[model samples]
Target: MKKTFLKIGLLFAIVGLLAGCKDPSSEAPQSEGPSVSTTGESISEPEVVLTDEEHNIAVNYIARSVPLVIERTGSTIPTNVFRADAEPPLPIPELKYGNDLILITYGELKYEDEINGVYLYPEYTVTYSYLEGENYASFEFAVDDKGDDYAIPDYPRYDAEYDSGGNPIHTVPPAKAARLYATIHIGERSTRFNIDMILHPQEIIYEFTLDEARAQPMGKIVKVYGYFNGYFADWNNGVICDGDVALGLFKINDYREYMQIGKLYEVIGQYTVYHGLPQLQWIKRVTEVAAADHPTIAAPEAIVVNANDFAEQLDIGNELSGPLKHKVGTTVILNFPLRYKKMLDRDGNPVEPGSLELGKHADVVLTGKDGNNFEFEVKLSLNYHMGIDDQAAFRDFFVANPTADIYFTGPLGAYDAITLAPFAFEGSLSLTPPVV
Candidate 1:
């Protein structure tokens, strides 16, 4: 007999739990069954117990949203820093918010020592929708981190103004509560719902290995680890090249600064095939795991091809090269050199001193070993900040020697699927031939 795990939620929607918070003074309400969204429809009418895997899914969704809440509440720490505490050693959040039908659980920041006289602000307030049939809801809030955990930057800590019981007395007023707002989307409909800061559920998250993730169907949301090899700021995108395979992130936020080439990261997103290449779209989170440098990736056995070979394949509309489609992301070396083309000005005339701006476009003529030639488009590096000195040297070298056997090394990209015409990324170019 074969056993299957529960599939995650829809394409971009998050998951939610079956609990809610009520007025603390009143008795707790018993839940009749699993939650029903604002649409008044339930996936299953009978009360369904969540499986272990389902529980992990639900908890992780909540965990991902917590940082947003914390940030909105005015916490100075970054979301990644806060999330790092969600694991063991740091106790999981156990506080509950709403009633049974709509439950929200979270952990509180533990204070190291009690204060005698200092005034303290409330940690934070969250406003989240209680959507039916979902494990989590999208939330919105503002952040202002003062000094000492609160967004409040300045306020000297003085001695105790405590009573005989050793309770601290406040010199300043407590922080104001945040205004709450809630809106929920269920299926094709949208409606208003209630939100409460509730108790924390048992924290759990299932980490997937790369192999396990690759086996899942396309568009499945999963968490996996990899090292960043490429990033495109123009597209607000990046790639995680991990152990012979690479995954693309369509939108990278917060972690953009940390996504230097060769840095390790753990990312969460939906896997989908985009233009014959697998990409992780709707990227929810990217966590930097390692800042240590990784070795430069060497080209795999690239079947060297000439301009004639490329043209023949294009003419026949078939891959004359070995698995060029599979080599969509891997590095392939072109054996021949390319003749440089001057940059064109606005009036369509070639510039003599030639502007070498970052992300500027240039072209070259590929000269095959057998004398075949084809124009090849080349883009300057997006990460021009890596080495200004190197860029200047290369620019000068390019200007001085236009026919210095220009070498191209980079992850191959295709704009037209049929033509399969590839371009060289700026990160993968090397004009200075390797020292013999």
Candidate 2:
């Protein structure tokens, strides 16, 4: 039989051992069996004795390890600068077999010291509950680099001053390598796995321009220079543009400090297509190259489009030649005689406009000129400064005026088809038509 190795939890399993190891800590509560040693050293392999529940969990884990290893064999993993309150790593799942529960704990392991590598200090006693009737066994371990306790020299910090938009300004850290290790303890038996990951700065392509980067193949990592145009708080991303072309910056949490509207920036990331929209994901770096003293300096002007032009542009596919192709990722002012068809949720289910929920996207379908239908995804949640009552009032306006000459501004993106992603409704939407 062919042996298959898989990723059980945080790290993939390369090899498994049935030997008993030193207990994690002396302070940990003792399990209901023979007392495990606490000497912090490897002991001789003991006779294996597992109850039916323990045997099932271990069997399920060993059975599923192969594909996980193959899946993550060459995957790029994001690394963060060690912070005390940083978000915890994703949790591992617990496998269930019958009525008995099998608890798994993260054991201690040695941290590799690569040059300028970010270290992973995994918690030792994270517990997971096994749900009833599930056959698979999985576990999650929280890893963080304990603040000053394991501080390295020359680590970068955010600047004390805030930008005009109240966002803190900071310098991005250089890429580093990291090798993480963790021990998985199932009942009395333990297995160890180590993950080798390059923290950031993976194969930088600083030569590519924003437009050139867009042409590169999917999943290719590239670095581009552009100006910060706008942020989509609803989607947790921002838009950046060179003088000619614009690209969406996905997942700004790591680089939020350097984000300021109209500032020039250098971004390094993997080019990806999210729901048909071109975006850069797993952003490695966002460095402000030039500051924007005024908001209008680096902001890209929105392209004005009428309903007929908008529908014609939407009909042209992203790869085909059309006016909207060049306008993707940039803002556009759309003026159309509105005819509301229906409202839908992200999953494409019909939803009454008045019943739209907060923090969820309300995808409203509207009939354009020549009966061309396009979607307007209302992202009022992105308007962070809006009150609940104001948001509701703004939402009701769309349903209330089902047929009116309306104008709105939003970044032109594609999701299954052309979409107008309006981050806020205040200044973007108007009942009266624009002067275009």
Candidate 3:
């Protein structure tokens, strides 16, 4: 079996796990070359202990109805008078909210780190879900002083601070933040991450009130507001959808429409960490309309969402979040594996004799799990000329020989250098099927 792993997830999802690396955002550090001038002291990476009272204070501070900054004795040092290599190391900080979930996050300085030989993927993954029992996101980072690992791909990180209109709030210098961010991917479930921002010199300026999604508006201006889900960030117009625990559908007008097998999209939708991989709510831009004057009246042919001029008034619904464990059927619908077989040869190229060769069997399906009751029309490969016509022939053959029991005999999908044709033979399952 040729296993070619594919990446699927949100634009801000996790990619690879490198040891030693703090967070993906811990790159292109702030004092890359050291601050221009002043009393340059920074927060050092230390093992600090906090009491239950302190933890509650930090939690309450973050979830406050109105954003306010809390003073940390250790963070009293300012960012003035810093040298390129004089800055301290970034540490992994955690805060337990007692009632709410725990938050373990690294500071933004890590993302701004500028050690000549040290390089980390600009990947930030902090996993924490309100969904009990299952929730965790980790990362492994390694710094190559010799710069041997340098096959860096372009993973553009969008800082939505200016509202598409030019404005600088939290101002950081201009640099690629050249850190290797791994290929993004989608997971098999929904996840969430919690981030808190702390300022230097002043105080913890503004905190997230359990709803606002914060973003880097300008160099130091961190804009905080309400975010719908942990995955969907309002900064990029991200929205979460239903039936998205597993396969997410990412869509946007600004992005390329045509999707290829290997091509990946940094889709800005709702996402979370699931089973170590980044799982996000599928994001797709769907035009929905509502009556501008009255929020309800529908145009006659208003079936299409775009039909309503006041589409902006309508809201995107939330995911079906209840108990973390929703008892699906005895077995999960997704777990019902589709019986498949590689009717083709090792060389994804067509077989000389387009016919079902001996030594080949298939897992044939009699009906679709959706009760479509569909038995695929099967056709044995005739003479090595693989094309859509062959699929047509299979349908034709199935119509003629409905009971011939001829197993599939053609390449399901074979492109240049890539041959993955897991042609389904059956639909149902045996033994213990999966559950949602």
Best-performing candidate as measured by TM-score: 2
Model 1 RMSD in angstroms: 20.9
Q: What is the TM-score of each candidate against the true structure?
A: 0.39, 0.48, 0.18
lDDT tens per residue, model 3, 273-339? 2221122223322223222532222211101111121111111111222221111101112222223
Clashing pairs in 2: 4-66, 5-65, 5-66, 6-65, 6-66, 92-139, 92-140, 93-138, 95-136
Report the lDDT tens digits of candidate 1 across residue range 215-313.
Answer: 556656678777776654443556666555555666675665556666677787766655545566666567776434423432123345455544443
Q: Find the 10 residues in a row with the least total lDDT in model 1.
A: 147-156
Question: What TM-score does candidate 1 get on C-alpha atoms?
Answer: 0.39
What lDDT does the true structure give each of the candidates?
0.40, 0.49, 0.23
Ranking by lDDT: 2, 1, 3
* Between candidates 1 and 3, the TM-score winner: 1
User: Model 3 segments beyond 4 Å from truth?
Assistant: 1-74, 78-338, 343-373, 376-429, 432-436
